[model samples]
Target chain A: MADTAKIDYKNIFYPPGGILLWIIIYLELLTFGIALVFMALNARTEPEVFHESRMLLNTAYGAINTVFLLSSGWCMAQSVHFLKTENFGKSKLFLKLTLLGGILFLALKSVEYYDKVEAGLTVGYNVFFGYYWTLTLFHVIHVIVGIVILLVLGRTLSKKPETLKVEDYESGAAFWHMCDLIWLLLFPIIYLLF
Target chain B: MERTFNATWLVLIVLTIISAVFANLDFAYAALIILGLSFLKFIGVAFFFMELKRANVFWRVLLVAFVVLLLTVVWAV
Candidate 1:
């Protein structure tokens, strides 16, 4: 295991997942941030529509999914930590837990989507659902990609732990946490706030 | 690192619950408080789970600035 303390964190090229992933992270956050700002502005123009549309959302599901994602994020961080400490067995276990969390979130989100569709709240339903579907569907795509990345990394780690670089593991964790962070942005503005 | 991550997760869950509770209450500032808690959650995940604490200062400050700018825009709207 490399000594994390010995590494010069001040180096622009040496974040946990490397500079390239950090760049992607920044760009991704900016994209979502701009969309959210637009949504807020749109809400300001039609507060009643936004408020009533928010009422149709199930806060319990949003809150529960937040727990699921956050817990998974914790597992991902733990997996990386164990990898750093050279505990491959525990690291693999945590990776599985993280995958489970992602799966649960996707499953629950599908149910929520189904409910909305049944209630005639599709993307073109109104401006509010327009933002809802676009922002969340974009986030869902990221989560799907994140899950695929984790699956690939988990396979490599399980079959050949020695072959998995710490950088690769950390990069996967970073992407997964990006999903968590984006959801944190979306949940409050969409489900809680009008 | 384990303790820190665990503690951070606990705080995030608690904050989520608090946000949910506040969502139930109708008040002018409930939205503000909930958004504030959400931003706090964002910071916790970025710093602890994403390991920004070990990153360069530029990355850390960039994230903080992003959150502040986002919060300001959302609040202004």
Candidate 2:
């Protein structure tokens, strides 16, 4: 079993993935949070346009992407759990599943983007589309970066699972979950709410 | 521990579906309801999936506070 006694819960610098990773997490959240707040404030000025633009978004697509990220996050958490337990095989398996979920999410998002462009719902379409393109595209970029991180982690796990530090694994998982969390905020405000 | 992760994932999925359905309907507080559901999912992921529950209380409080601040701003605006 893993040495739970070694964990320092009270130490501010000893959270999972170390304090440095936590700093990155906080900064990323703050950045996205500001963008979202701006979007909300703009929505207040043009409620009707916001509402109509929100209506044009496909809720089913947003919801499906949400599920993909959440499920992938679960796989990530599981992969970390298995790593801690020294179950390298299961850990690698779950890691692959996490990658699959992320790839699927990006694939679906590409399709959605294609449809939006074909319909002329480009970035310059309106204030709402501007926010929509900016926020979601920024989020998509994060997801792509997250997938690259996971890919590197997966390669290490395959080649040298024993050398993979639990802290590093947790950091990757934390980053992936950040993507999911941002989507959680974005989907509701941009797709559901006016 | 595995069971806890499984349960959290299920709850998150259920909440996502509920919020999607809520979004499709018209009501006075539909926005509030949908945003509220998203809030719960956010907590679920942060605490369970992110394993912040195992971290210091400071981290937990910081995350919760961030979400609350975001939601409050979104709702008020």
Candidate 3:
């Protein structure tokens, strides 16, 4: 039998794998959930106030963003699968595709914000708008951070194709997916509920 | 072998589409129904696509507990 007792202790805590990374990703998710609960409770108490303010939102824009995030998550998952199989070239391609999705989401969000401003529906418009913009924008910022991480990871993977990149890529993808999952809740609450 | 087209995903998608269609119906609890369906879809995705079904028992319990807590809060509010 092969003796499997000689394990390296120095690198165990921050394993070359993604366990620590996932812990951080899940921590962010927990924070997002807490924020969501706080906002939802505030909205529940003032349905009419929130509804009137929610009218300022563009459902089409929200829907497009949702699609963008979902597709980006799919791309990220595909990239992880490719990386697991050592197909670094295909993995890079999928990562770039995912990055494009993130870029498109941000561009659409900017246009939506511009339209909201033109329609005189600023954050001060109402409490609902306040919460809506705050939550979505916070999620947008997370998306931007996620994209930056992906871009960096992409650059690294392209340079060192043989390195164990799957864990980092999967952790980043999980974080982005959490962002999308939150928005899926936020969209109907802030836009369609009214 | 794990199947490619998850029946859970298909069922959840159908439920979601139905819920969306029902949202247009002039019913008193249509919104509640939609929200419930959305929650169900969330569970389906979490368990299947996210591979939570294969997670450790403690993690699975934690997820269910959190979900129940959220639902309770929603109901209370």
Candidate 4:
């Protein structure tokens, strides 16, 4: 097979769902990137506080969450591909797999948060943990939104195929991918960097 | 798309694990190296998995710009 770059998605302006979706995605990506840069800059002021708090984090847990999100993004991408091909059953199967990944991601993230709370290291503990909890908890909200969108998409696929186009499915898929994209950026920023 | 997306996933996983290893290294540029690898992973997901490869140049330019700004900030800070 040729590279994906060679496979045309038809129009640049009319990507899967609509141009507006891409706009939202672009803004979302930029917003998260800026927030991350802000965190990085803030870390520079009190490097020790950030470092000490960062060390308390379980890199393994973050790594696991990374894997889960990555897997879910993969599944969601596959689902959209199958949906475009009009392979309804395969699409749904992959959608369910994506949902499974989302569930696991939330579960692991919950455990990580619980550890912090139990240790009296909540967001109020310090600036680093503040950004940590704020960013991660916001991401959790996004994942929850993604899951709900997927459920709505699932219902659409099963009950009313005619009401939605493949591009509409792509909108939801893109949102899920956005969550994955944000996490991809967030992981190294919080877990690996000083 | 399926084959390419699968290849993209493979690259993402490999880069992630490699960066995790880089974090354990005591090298001076480990942070930069990890960030660079992660940038590659970001490209993989955006281009292949997210289908931005075939997307219009608008998305490509905007996203690449976002990466540049992110890198600049992280590098400077």
Candidate 5:
């Protein structure tokens, strides 16, 4: 009974090496919260300006991006599972799928930005446009970071299957999911709330 | 445990569609519902698909606290 209790305790509270990943995750969330507060205060001060400027955004593009990110998250989840089971081939395949999704998201986002530029909705046009472009561009930067991480992970999984690095994969996936989740909030706030 | 996508994925997909539909409605509280559902979907992805459900309670508490803090910040804004 004592041995069983010890085993249970170990399983419950003392994961061997997940602390670093958790700390990084917390810090990322903190940074996102700070940015959200900054934007919210800016919006509150100039509600009319922000609302009028928000009208220029394309909701369809925002929705499509949301779906893309969600699907990418799904694929990453599958890859994580496959990695855990040591199925290198399946893991590599799913990671490639995830990378494809990320690429597609970026391509669509670029097209959306191009459309905005052609329509003369430049960032310096107004305070709201400034915030809108800053926030969305900041998110786009994160997506780019996520894509790079996915590419690295895919490469590692394909080349060095022995060094699976499940934690790295999981952390990268978590970060990507965070990016997606934030956009899920931002999309509605920018496009639908008006 | 054998890896297989669960009902949560289906629920997330349905909620995403519902959120889009709700956005078009004339109801005053539709936005709130959409936000609420989005929060639920986020939690589902974090806990289930990310396998955080099987993680240590400390980690779970940390995540929940961070999310609550984010929600509070949003509310304050």
Candidate 6:
């Protein structure tokens, strides 16, 4: 008998990002997840040191950072939404707004780190500060990457307009959202969980 | 969609503000409460902003499970 296999189109789910993108996301999350777990376990050892060091860090700044990222996330979503609706101008505008958010986040984060280093609290200062700097700096690197991705998207949209696929826009947005998710885990862990 | 996004954004901001205010509280479960709220914010971002609300079962479940795993491991520690 001939093969009667049929492709199940409706059952296939390729998230906004390509499948490989999700795999990369999973790996990134796992890397951070292990770090977070180590931090938490280590925190249980010297709660006092961790809490004291954590207090040196600014909760308000972390909150502000969260707000900025969340707002930027909203902007990215809007950019994609407008793009889907075929409103190129609005999409471009929102993408710019999203990039601005990333810029502001990096700026504020740098100031926060500056205060820490100036206070003589480097990553090796203690276990908590170690994780504090390590985890947050790693996240900072991801944010930088996320911003660069957005800029590339912006460039493509501007220079080659109409050559961009919706998936291309969403691929960048999904990665940006991954950044948001990582921070959401980190904010409470490093800044608040104490 | 605009209104939905705006309202969700407002709610997320409110949650963050609430968490910040509760930062220095001297309660035993304060951390849990704050983490819970942050998780809620994550939910909003993932579902609404990331367009995961209509995602197939696997992706949605996987994301939620990941969040839960983080919460559980953190709480355990």
State each candidate's chain A TM-score: 0.96, 0.96, 0.83, 0.92, 0.84, 0.92
B1-77, model 4: which lDDT tens digit per residue? Answer: 78888888888888888888887678899888988987888888777777887777877888888886797688788
User: Which scores greater on TM-score, model 1 or model 3?
Assistant: 1
Segments of candidate 4 deviating more than 4 angstroms: A1-12
Which of the numbered candidates is closest to the native, going by highest DockQ? 1
- Global local distance difference test of model 3: 0.65
| lDDT by residue (tens digit), candidate 2, A1-194 | 22333567467778876788888888988998999999999999999999999899998999999999999999999999998888989999999999999999999999999999999999999999998999999999999999999999999889887677787788899899989989999999998988
Residue A118's lDDT in candidate 1: 94
Q: Is 2 or 4 the stronger prediction by TM-score?
A: 2
Worst 10 residues of 2 chain A by lDDT: A1-10
Instruction: Write candidate 1's Cα lDDT for A49-163 as tens digits.
Output: 9999999999999999999999999999999989888898999999999999999999999999999999899999999999999999999999999999999999988888877
lDDT of 5 by residue, A117-168 (tens): 9988988987767767887898889889988888887887777767656666
| lDDT leader | 1
Report chain B TM per candidate: 0.94, 0.96, 0.74, 0.92, 0.79, 0.95
List, residue by residue over A1-194, the lDDT tens digit for candidate 4.
01113234656766654578778888888878888888998999999998888889998898888889998999999998887676878988999999999999999999988989999999899989999999999889999999999999999887765565766787888888888888988889898887
What CAPRI grade goes to candidate 6? medium
Instruction: For model 1, give the interface RMSD.
Output: 0.9
Share of reference contacts kept by candidate 1? 0.88
lDDT of 1 by residue, B1-77 (tens): 89999899999999999999999998889988998999899999999998898888989999999988997899888
TM-score result, candidate 6: 0.94
Clashes of 4: 0
A1-194: candidate 6 lDDT, tens digit per residue: 02113323224356656556677877888899889988888889988998888888889999999999999999999998887777888999999999999999999999998998899999889998888888889999999999999999999877765677877787899999999988988998888887
Q: List CA RMSD, all candidates.
A: 1.6, 1.7, 5.0, 3.7, 4.6, 4.9
Residues A1-194, candidate 3: write the lDDT tens digits: 01113223233243222346546645765666676677678777887886667665666676667667666666666676677667788878888988998999999999999988898888888777787778888889988898888888887788866654455555676666666666656655565654
By lDDT, the candidates rank as 1, 2, 6, 4, 5, 3
Clashing pairs in 6: none
The TM-score of chain B in candidate 4 is: 0.92
